[model samples]
Target: MTESVQAWFFLLLAFVGGVSAAAFSFRLLGYLAVSLRRPRDLRRRYGAWAVVTGPTSGIGRSVALKLARKGLNLVLLDLSAANLQETSDMIRSRHGVKTRTVVFDLSLVGTPQGDDSMRRLRAAIDGLDVGVLVNNAGVARPSVAYLHEADVELWVRMLKVNLWALTEVTAAVLPGMVERGRGAVLNMGSASSEAIPSFPLNTIYASTKRYVAKFSRSLYVEYRNKGIDVQCQVTHNQPISRPAFKFHQQE
Candidate 1:
């Protein structure tokens, strides 16, 4: 290649590298800014006790650690023993906050095991006023050819985990918060609930999330006067480290 062509290539590579470095630096700075501000913000806020379902990883795990660092004792719930123990250990060693792990599948309905699981959780956290409830335990079923082709059992399981289990666990902790006259309920929702144009393949999962949004909103309105705060966040993007599955909107 000619020297001019080589110089041009080198310049182009250098320009691309500079742009990439600048973007990364910007993100790092933004993260640092947020980190610096968070402690001051939490200092102004009262510490609260929290229960986080699906606290083993992803958004649930991040929220648990953040809240724990902000002085909230956590009750971590997940079906996986390894993930649950890892999260508990991280909270204890890093944040020095109390951590409890409960392993229970949220999909089975009207089961003795489910009821017993809740009872044990209540007993373990006995007397600690749970001021925050993060209902994040949800399961997603893979799409078949279409909504009709989706397994009926999968649909039912999704309802059990996303809707029924969320309700049961929230109900278990909420009464105490109401009695104490202060608490927050954060329910994980989805853009699919707002009728987003995701594939209809996941219709059942979307419908269950819609019910969660509606139920959470109604509970918020109903219990606001009793000093309960209910906030529903519609989560859309999963991290790149996870699988890249997309769904179109349902009819």
Candidate 2:
């Protein structure tokens, strides 16, 4: 009996090790493939125009600029008209790519105004050879708070902007890509989606990010063979600006 138990333990260990090794190898290969891909390859596979949400500041702005540099015409969407115009001008000056700006608040989704906003967004992209969609518009509470302590309006807005807006925008754009047989969708996710390092205070934010991750995974599976690549980029927190020296100095 002792010998049989020892054999089963060793077999189980070997099986686990083999599975781990295979998973690691597959990930390594995928990374290598992405690194080797060229800008022209993306243009050929996807198309000429790329749509980016939240293109006013920080990471979203960075992504929009990079796509412009890759020779893709841009459709910039943001809540602030001034910031949208600024980003559009900068991209046009630097990359000389065509740019269109759509300014509307995503947090108002599911309302009559939101429906009108969606109609305007559709009009902005109409007749353009759009190929890439970046669902990057998101929001979080100003400070950490427990579930009961959180503001009800802020929580509702968070859901509206982060999940509902993403769904609606993707739905609006995906059918065109499907008909054309090529496109890519990039969704931004947070590291909080992982099981480790539980977020005690930012519970709602973490849950929303996890939803983005799962939504991207399922979409990828459903559209992989249809020439649409869906990816959820999981990111860790990074300082966007200098830390405030005093509590009153915080922006």
Candidate 3:
């Protein structure tokens, strides 16, 4: 009986080790494949124009600049007109590519005015050969607080901006991608989506981010064969409090 128990333990240990090694190897290969892709590959696989929501600041701005550098023309969307214009100008100057800006608040997604804004957004991209859509606009409460302590208004705003806006924008853009038979949609997610460590004091924010991951994964599976690549980029780091370059001139 003792010998049999020892054999079973060793077998279990070996199986776990093998699984871990295989997971690591697969991840390494995936990273290597992504690293090997060039800017031209993006243009060829996706298209020429890339749309970035929340392009005025933070990670959205960074993504917009990188895509511009890769020879993609830009359609920038944000709430601040001045900031959107500044981002558009910078992309044109640095990358020598064309850029168009659309300024609209995402927090009012279900309102009549929001519908008009969506119509405008669709109109703006109508004739363009858009290749990539980055649904990066989102909001969080100003500070962390327990569920009952959190501001009710902020919670509603977070849901609109983080969840509703993402779905609306993707719906508007995805049909075009499907018709064209080639495009990419990148949804920004948070590390909290994994929920392994259990985030505290920010329940609403974490839940919304978790929704983004599940939504993106579902879309990816649905459209993988239709030449649409959907990805949820899970970020672990917090946004920079101060950006190095001010993309917009202060009003």
Highest-scoring model, TM-score: 3
Better of 1 and 2 by TM-score: 2
In candidate 1, stretches whose alpha carbon ends up further than 4 angstroms from where it belongs are: 1-47, 195-199, 236-251
Would you list the C-alpha lDDT of every candidate in the order shown? 0.74, 0.80, 0.81
Candidates 2 and 3 compared by TM-score, better number: 3
**Model 2 lDDT vs. the true structure?**
0.80
Scored against the true structure, residue 79 in model 3 reaches a CA lDDT of 91
Candidate 3 residue spans exceeding 4 A from truth: 1-26, 37-40, 195-197, 236-251
How many residue pairs clash in all the candidates, one count each? 7, 0, 0
How good is model 1 by TM-score?
0.74
TM-score of each candidate? 0.74, 0.81, 0.83
The superposed Cα distance between candidate 2 and the true structure at residue 192, in angstroms, equals: 0.3
Q: Can you tell me which runs of candidate 2 are displaced by over 4 Å? A: 1-40, 195-197, 236-251
Inter-residue clash pairs, candidate 2? none
